[model samples]
Target chain A: MAERTNSKKHYRDNFTGWLLNIPYLAYTAVFFLIPLVWAVWLSTMDWNLMSPDRTFVGIRNFTGMFANPKIIAAFFNSFRYLAPIVVLCFLFGLLLALLISNLPDRIKGVTAVLFFIPYLTSGVATSVVIRFFFSYNSAFNHFLRERFDKDISWFQNPTSAFWIIIAIIVWKMSGYYALFLLSAIESIEPEVNEAAAIDGCVGFRRLVYITLPMILPTITTVIVLASGLAFGIYTEPYLLTGGGPNNATTTWLLEIYNTSFTNFRSGEGAAMAIANAVQIFVTIQLFTFVMNKLNRKFGV
Target chain B: MKRSSKIKTGILIAITAVLLVFSLFPLFYMVIQSLMPWDQVDKSMVLSHPTMKSYQYLLGSGNSSDAFMWVRSLLNSLIVSVPTAVVSVLVGLCVGYSVTKLHFRGKKIIYESLLFQMFFPGVILLVPRYILIKPLANHYLGMILPLCISTWAIFMYINYFTTLPNELFEAAKIDGLGEFGIILKIAMPMTKSVTTIVFLSMFMARWNELMWDMLVAPDIKMQTLNVLISTQFRTMGNFPGPMYAASVLLTLPIIIMFLCASKHFKEGISFMLK
Candidate 1:
């Protein structure tokens, strides 16, 4: 009986790890791995989401993504959203981080939450309020006209419409990003600041020369985040603009949705999605590669 | 030097205040817009004649089926979000403890893959995940399943689990309480920080879920609060006050939850990052 029990104990110990890991393995394989494979598979087919034409077309759908006009426009527009938002968010986020760092620690939490409220709030709702705020007939523009004799129709004009999107992104996101930057700033040893001060660093000059380089890694993370945010920006554009003003606000994801759902081109939509993933993967890798070199060069 | 430092302090305070107002203005405007009576919700937006008419309209005392969508969406959100949170946390805890504690084959591979998965943007999976799950669209489970796992959360829980004292595990072993019991009794109870972190972040992500929710639950009755509000913004563009009220309603629960649980969340989140 003792020998039988001993052998059973050995079997249980050996298999216990597998037993415990069963749930994660099963869930991840079914949900994540399988879906990933299915997406790639579906992208190669010409099926319009259901029934009849279930033919595989190799890379035709992939090539066709670039050929499509709306897809091309969306490709450029993602950059338009990505560049300005990333740049301005870094600037504003850094400033907010610096300012927040100066506040007494006791009240910092309250202030951070207040600022992060927008970030936490639904992007869809904020965009709705913003759309109303910038509406041509609203008091904001009316006041602008009354004060400066200028009544710019924000939504009707593509340039202004794009900027309004940028404003909404920066307003809602910068503070949240600033919290990450704040922690980075707080991590800097005070002695370094004193050392820089002794070497004549002060104010804006000090911030540019001394502080910016120190937080480059955190800034890299922020850039990655902001860019990811730009790509995933569906709610605001879909709800606020509906990719309107002559498709000026249409994004990659929006185009994909339009093609697959509205246009009944699921295969093409999946292809567009694959192409988007590749671009995001490449850019993120590039950011990481460049940031790593910069980190080394900047002696961090 | 003292004078210059004082000036710097003033400048910092000024900047902080300005940014605070800019950051907070939309939410403030939303509240004001929701409360302002229709008559005074004019071009100027001066709060001369404030009223709760919009909220009234929102609650559907106006008899226009307005409240039905909002209430239904909120309930749908609760149905989906609650399950997603509970499911993800349970999975995270199980996987985290198993990978950290038990001696398993392919353990290193599992750990590394989760790390690798973390680096990829979750949105990249959005399209594919949607396509695979599209048939089950409109069902609550369809929306919730795609968001049920987070590799990052798993790793976070693993990191937390590894930091736990090994003595408890040994004691549990000596007592012959078994691996599951050790994890359930000692490892789990002790890692409340990570639990709160995992639960809150998952809850928030699931709550604010829009993309998948939209794709999977586009049917009017199945839409989430966020999706419903977004659709409201699109369909009811003319009714700014009532829409703003809806926006406020959607945002208020999160704000209140954050306020109540923020002390826990701040530490939890910061630890996750570290």
Candidate 2:
């Protein structure tokens, strides 16, 4: 009787737990899991978004994506944006973080909030202002033409426009990543820093040797986070340049948007989105591998 | 030595000052541009002329249809955000409570599956999620439902719940409370701060959300603020000043929220960082 009662109680416990988990289960099924499966199925079909009849095309959508030059260029542009963004976000984020945290106590809180305010604001707002700042007749460019005899068309030229996107991303991301990495930086013991200083470790040398290796994990985190964010960069390219100058700034997400919604080719868009995702996954894994090796080599 | 250290501090402060300007210039420029006359935005003397005409126009001084659309979209944003915030937190709380505190079969599998959703590239589901939820596109359900489940918030709750002492739950159980009662009586009240962090995080993300909002809420009558602002920007050629005004209008509520509850906002970011 005792053993039977014990088993019954255990069964009741399991039931209670599952009952609580039902909401998440049902939600994930409807939104995430089901959609994920449906996304794969949709990729295999030929259908406009509005049509009920979807012909089973079976990988033609995937094959067709490879033939498109704009799609290919968008991928290349993503990497182009990703490379500079990764480097610049690390450089500026780390340096600014070090600078801000090292400030006098009273000023530190005020400055952190001020620096972080940009991160809190929506991407659309900032992109609009940036677009204006780089417009043809803006005062800054006009000043450049008048005084320095230097005027590069930001939006009109592909290379210059690409750099503008890179600059905006770096400007927005660096401070945000700085705050992200700050917690890790704070956890490092002050004694280690004091000992490093006693060993004549200061300035850039100290940062490169002592700080960089010690915070390798956080650095990895920052890089991964920045890179992942780079993949989903729709707001900037869409709002700022309209993926323009002959699709020079069009990213993976932008191309997918165009292929699916703009062209009403939902099947092909799904295929492209999947292909883009796989590439991003592979890229992130490679990045993580290299970082891990570096972390180990640095003896962190 | 003291003088040199002071100089070093001064230099650091100067660097900080420069960074602050770099960080805030877009915002400052937006504010300045919003005040400038519409025709002068791209002109040489951009800042010389300042007027509230852009703001007045956006505020519907003449009650223009375009301005009226913007006002409606702002309402649409609030409508989308409030429910999303509530749903995300509650669902996260449920999952967090189930996995961490409750005893169940396949609980580990459930936990892992929930987390696995995070790594799946969000890019892949854009089209499919749209199609599946497309029927609701004309309704608010399409706009809100698909965007509500945040793995970040879910995991944050799970991590937080682990830190709570088990004795409270055991004591509540001994007092003849059912699992739901215990969760409601103890877990819900105790996890107030975590709930705030999750709710605000979801709220902000949903509020600023554009891609899905644009996709689902395609009806011009029911677009969100971001969709409205960006659509205006794309279609309306050469009206940069009013666009700047709209951008300011879009960002102002978030800025106000940031000032009010920056702690919760930073906490949410830190949770993601972790």
Candidate 3:
């Protein structure tokens, strides 16, 4: 009788817990899980919004994407953006974090807020402002022409367009990443610093040997975070270049948007999106693996 | 040695000053350029002749062509983001509260699923989500539904609730406080900081969101400021003032929020470090 009563109490507790979770659970089912399954099913059928009939295409959409040039460009451009973003963001964030950490406490708070402003600015807003700056009759272009006898259409050229996107992303993200590194830097024990100082470790030597090793895990996290962010690069490229100048900056998200929505090839778009998802999963795993190896090797 | 330390501090300050110029110059330029007349914009570094024509235009006092639906979209932004932030927090708080405090069979699975969703690429569901939301297009339901739950918000609450001592809840139970009553009175009161952080971030995320907003709401009457800015920017090249003004307007609320609650904003960012 005692055991049965205890089991009943446990069941009641479980029921209450589930009842409390009903909102999130029901929401995930309708919005997330249902769409997820539908996405997989849609990948096997050729369909569009206007059409009432759907034709089953089997795996043709998946296979065709591998051979498509736009798909191929999208695949490669992700890596093209990923490497520089990780490197530049890491370097710039480290510099800012180190500089800000050295400041007095009052100024430090003010400066961190000031630096974080760009991250808060919407990509659309920033891109609009940047577009105006680089317009043909703008002061920037006029200065380029008069000073250096160069009047370049910034967005028309593929290489300049690519570099412009990278510059914007780096500008936007570096400070946010700095906040992460700043917290990590601040948390380092003063005892550790004092001991290193007593042993004559200071300045650049201390940074390289002592500080760098201590902050490796955060560094790893930041790099992985930045790398994952590269896959989601849509706003700038979509607004500025339209994946143009010989498809130089065509990102996976851009291609997916165009193929699915613009062209109404939902089946093919689903296939590409699935592939993008798999690639993201694999790349993150690879990055985590590499970072883990580095962490272990660095004696962290 | 004291002199060297002072010199180091001076050097650091100088470097920071230089970097600040680079970081802040674009925003400064935007504000300045927005103040210029259409003809004078992007022509000079200094705003010799400032006007409110751009801001006026964005507010629908300019030529009809230039006054295409900016303020309405701003309202739409508010309508969508506020509800999204509120609903996301409530759901996250409840789920977070239950997961941490209650005994459940599938709590571990739910947590694991949330973690997977956090790492999941959101782009993969675009096609299917569009199809599902197609019937509800031009409706606020289509715009706000998908974004009403975030894995990050749930995690934030979960992590915060975990830190509170279990004995407090036990004590409340001993005092005949029901589970819901304890959550409402005790748990909610203690989690004000975490709630603020989650709510602010969620609001910001939904406000800044463009693609999903654009996709779901193809109706011009229902578009957010971001979508309006993006679509108008393509053709508004010659008249640059309104574009700058619109961008400024889009960013203003966020800037204000950050300035007001910078400590909480920084705390939110630090949560990611954990």
Each model's lDDT: 0.79, 0.82, 0.88
What DockQ, between 0 and 1, does each candidate earn? 0.56, 0.67, 0.74
Error of 3 at A16 (Å): 2.9
Q: Candidate 1, residues A100-148: lDDT per residue as tens digits?
A: 8887677677777778777778887788788888887788888889899
Candidate 2, pairs of clashing residues: none
User: Which residue pairs collide, candidate 3?
Assistant: none
Compute the interface RMSD for candidate 1: 2.7
Clashes of each: 1, 0, 0
Model 3: how far is B91 from its true place, Å? 1.4
lDDT of 3 by residue, B183-255 (tens): 8899878887788778878898899998898899988899999888898888888888989998889888988
The residue ranges of model 1 lying beyond 4 angstroms of the native Cα positions read A1-14, A198-210, B1-10, B65-67, B121-128, B165-168, B175-177
Which candidate leads the pack in lDDT? Answer: 3
Off by over 4 Å in 3: A1-12, B65-68, B265-272
Q: After superposition, how far is residue B224 of candidate 1 from its true place, in Å?
A: 1.3
CA-based DockQ, model 2? 0.67
* Residue B244 in model 2: lDDT: 85
Q: Comparing chain B with the reference, what is the TM-score for each candidate?
A: 0.89, 0.89, 0.94
